[model samples]
Target chain A: MNHFFEDSVFFGVTLSFLSYGLGVLLKKKLKLGILNPLLVSIVITVIVLVVTDMDYEIYYNGAKYISYLLTPATVCLAIPLYEQFEILKKNVAAILAGILSGVLTSLSCILAMVLIFNMNHKQYVSLLPKSITTAIGMGVSEELGGYVAITTAIIIITGVFGNVIGEFVLYIFRIKEPVAKGIALGTASHAIGTAKAMELGEIEGALASLSIILSGIITVGFAPVFAQIH
Target chain B: MKYLRQFGIILFISFLGEIANYAIPLPIPASIYGIIILFLCLELKILPLSSVKETGKFLIEIMPVMFIPAAAGVLNVWGIIKPSVIEYIAVMVISTIAVMAVSGLVTQLVIRLTGHSGHQ
Candidate 1:
């Protein structure tokens, strides 16, 4: 099976598209509240890699074409952000205050764990930006001599996990306000979590988008200072 | 003509961020430095909304794709990461829920205190 498709772009794109497509199909059919398309796709891809014993480098080589799309996708977020600026501006103070508090909470908890476990600085630094998005978190972690791979894993896990349970917890607490729900998830979990918040409602989606950026900015601002303290 | 100036401003800040990241002793990443510079620019009216809006919008749209590169790292850790998959999974699941609960409660409390009453 591996020899047949040793060098083919279709290999990567097909696996990616198929995994995500099937995941989305499962999500719709099963009505599984937390079955994220991205997560499921990733799992499927990993299983393929392991089963076929194919090299990850080869898979990435084929997928590199699609990877270029990331820049434009990031740029697309501006539309919603611009559209929702009115709400963001109106509640800027409260929202900022809440988001910052949540960020602080996540960082503090991670640092506390580091100390409790008696982990070394390498582990400590890797987890420093655990709550932020992967790109930024990986960068910060590498600069501080931490493991970027671990940090990236932590960031994605945090994002997918936050997204999966975020809405349910909101319902559990009887917190129905779209704006509040959006801000909470985005600030705590970043973009993927925000995407889930969007599914709940437009207002929630808007707020989540706004919060994701704001939280990223805040995390960017706080990471250095926080890292220094630890 | 105006758009040109906005583009220049963003590019300049991005450059400044890179420079500061290399030259300064601050323990922060450069792109983040750019974000800080941009944030200050927005606050000071040095970079108007109309100008930076397009560039900012561009970055936000494709934000998800950024994960692709990092997700690639999963490959590097394949051998090591697999051993503790279940442990990591538990942490991932539990911590995500914890974050949602705590952040949601805190946000709602703040909203209630602020008295917006917009929540429906």
Candidate 2:
């Protein structure tokens, strides 16, 4: 059993796929709030790794191939952004200004939380880019000497949390504007929240796509300056 | 052959982005460079939208699966996360809501100011 997991080629796919399969099954079977396939898969993977006493490097060795797909996936965002170009052109100024504030708010909120909770600097840096996609968020965290794993965790949590609660917040605040809803979804949760925005309508989906990239670009540019702040 | 070619286009752009990262003076990442190049390609009519549209949608639809490994890596940092789990959740939830409110309000305000209806 121990040596079985040591093989990168076999371990990563076998375990990851098995866990993900189970996750999908559970999601279909159970209608619980915590039935997130990603979360379920991660929890199972962690448990299996811990139980087998297998090294993450071995697991990652195979899993990194899947992770590499993110590059093309990131590029794929251009299609929807392209589809939404007309709307983007019409509201370019509003979208840009909203994104500019969205990026700053995300950063400042992290800082404010750190100050209020007196959290450590390392964690602060790690959480700075939670509002964007993992690829850019990981880069921002690594550049600032933050722990990448921590950043990844915070990011997944933020995305899932926002995805779950976004509508309630919108309703409570009476935020009826589609542009507002789309911007909120993309800026706060990146792609996952954009997935929710898609269900709202085409314009919302397009706006969400536009906002994710805009927010990512803004975060990339804003991160260094933020890193230097504290 | 078709999807392969489309994927190839994106991969080639990614390759150029990797090269640009080192060559360019700016701090932008290769992925961003790729995104920018691709966006411009679409905008300038250099890369027709139809070629990549299918492959792009196919890739984006399954993007969630790619995040598994990255999120699974969190096991390594469990020690840090365990101590501040509550604080972490509090901060994340609060900040997420705050960012959403701020961005949404700002977008609506900006749209209204620009004489756009934003009625929907």
Candidate 3:
């Protein structure tokens, strides 16, 4: 076990890569709707834990090295947004207006529920960053004394549900433009939703990327003010 | 030249994000500061198209890898989450559905208000 402890970081990175690889394999083989890489990585990681009985701390010790990859990965999100600059320029005001309102509305509804339900401060803070992706959500949770675990679950669920049902709602409502359809899912669910948006098409993916960037800014900037109000 | 320009944009946004982390007292972390700065650059056209497109592409390509940290945290709290596994799953499933539904409604409302509903 001590030998395993020394190799935890190596193990963690191996698991991370394996999760990604397995996800790709599963997607190719199964054509499963909800079997996205992130979800797959999560399932695989949990199974590994249960079988090894490695405990969370030891596993984290192994995985912390790979954890640093998140920072660079985050720094890289600017790529797609940069690639889609032309489309964004064509419809700047409309996209901005749509994403902004959408983000604000999300915060309002979540906060309103928090207050109405009388969730304590931690739960409220945890849920505040719920609309964003997991990294930012954790950051938001940490800053506000919210439970990061709870926030992680919220972010994942937000992404999965948005990806699963976003298209149906858009079609039912007859949203034809790829850009509009993309922005709606991205704004609501962040990156996981953005993955689904990308699958829909380039235009939708672009809009979703724009939404991810905009919603992240809007949600982070506006959340504190709203938190103070309550 | 293209890579240089992209790196420059990344560095500039990173700087802005760092500054935000220092300046803002909010509990929310500040990498989002980079996101805000990126938004402003796009809005202002200061970063320029040639500067970041390549870099942005590279970044999103590896987006899924970024979740490693958050998922790792699950390792830390497994004990707490384990005993209450059913409760935790319920919270994850129920709250997720509720939040997504609410967010969709908001996006739809915004689309309608902007008179762009018909455009879609």
Best prediction by lDDT = 2
Model 1 lDDT per residue over A22-116, tens place: 87899999988767777777778888887888888788767776665443343334445555556667666667766777777766766666665
Please write out the lDDT profile of model 1 over residues B1-120, one tens digit for every residue: 765765566666767877877998755445556655665666567755676776555554334434443454477776655765554455455555655666667777777787763343
Candidate achieving the largest TM-score:
2
Which candidate number has the best DockQ?
2
lDDT of 2 by residue, A59-107 (tens): 8988888778777777667677777677677777788888889889989
Model 3, residue B78: what's the lDDT? 59
Give the Cα error of residue A111 in candidate 3, in Å. Answer: 5.3
Where in model 2 is the C-alpha error above 4 Å?
A8-11, A14-34, A51-53, A142-149, A195-202, A220-230, B112-120
* Cα TM-score of candidate 3: 0.73
In model 3, how large is the Cα lDDT of residue A29? Answer: 97
Model 3: docking quality category: acceptable
Q: What is the lDDT of residue B71 in candidate 3?
A: 56
lDDT of 3 by residue, A24-124 (tens): 89889998757776777777887877787766667777677665544444555555555566766666656776677676666676666666666666666
Model 3 misplacement above 4 A: A1-5, A89-97, A108-122, A133-145, A160-176, A220-230, B1-16, B23-30, B35-55, B78-120
- Candidate 2's TM-score reads 0.84
